[model samples]
Target: MANIKLTVEEMKYMALLQDLTGAVARDCIIDNENNRIIFIVRPGDAGKAIGRRGANINKLRRLLGKEIEVIEHADDLEAMVKNIFAPARVLGIRLAQRNGRKILYVTVDPNDKGRAIGKGGRKVNIARLVLKRYFDIDDIKIR
Candidate 1:
């Protein structure tokens, strides 16, 4: 795993998230360009992080003035990808090496292609960022 260094602001956000949701945050990614915050919580704590009717996340969004996304961490790359793209239903994940660079091939249900890609490809970009950060994946292809 690569060493991930957090800014003091991110650390403070993590502390706030933990206090608000009681979920241990594994990682936090702030996408300033997209005006969003992605939080990877310990497995089995997604519900807690989200809170009932998304109250916790909504509160964080209001407080931080950015959109919030909470994803549960997984030990396996495939499981992690699936968790990141939850509700979209990943049909499969295969790793491939091209030009000596590793890439992730993610197959999603035909009906969920749009959701997997998300508005302006934000979700796929998030997936790519997290995958590269944790697994060193060079790229991700959604099919």
Candidate 2:
């Protein structure tokens, strides 16, 4: 695990999320470009964060005026990557170190490649950002 830092604003968001969803968040990523907020909650708390029928997420979306995404945190890098790319079935995850940089190669179901990549590769970019922050991974290559 890498040393994680949360901005004051991020900490506020995390606090709000926990208050609203009853799930303590490990980290919060505010994607201003995407108009989205992503939260990584502690293990065994994803269900609580999402709530029944996604009521919690919907409420947060309305309150924050942006898309809200909740991901469960995992100690394992592979599991973390998989959680980040949920709804897009991942076939494999390979971590490679070259020189002084580390790269993650993720293989998703061929049919779900575009979904995993998201519009304009936004999903991959967010995944890469999260990986870099949480695991100190340098890059992510979606295959």
Top candidate when judged by TM-score against the true structure? 1
Clashes of each: 0, 0
**C-alpha lDDT of all candidate models, in order:** 0.92, 0.90
Q: Estimate, for each residue in 34-56, the C-alpha lDDT of model 1 and write its tens digit.
A: 89889989999999999999999
lDDT tens digits, residue span 21-127, model 2: 88999999988988988899999899999999999999999998999888889999889988889889999999999999999999999999999998888788889
**Where in model 2 is the C-alpha error above 4 Å?**
none
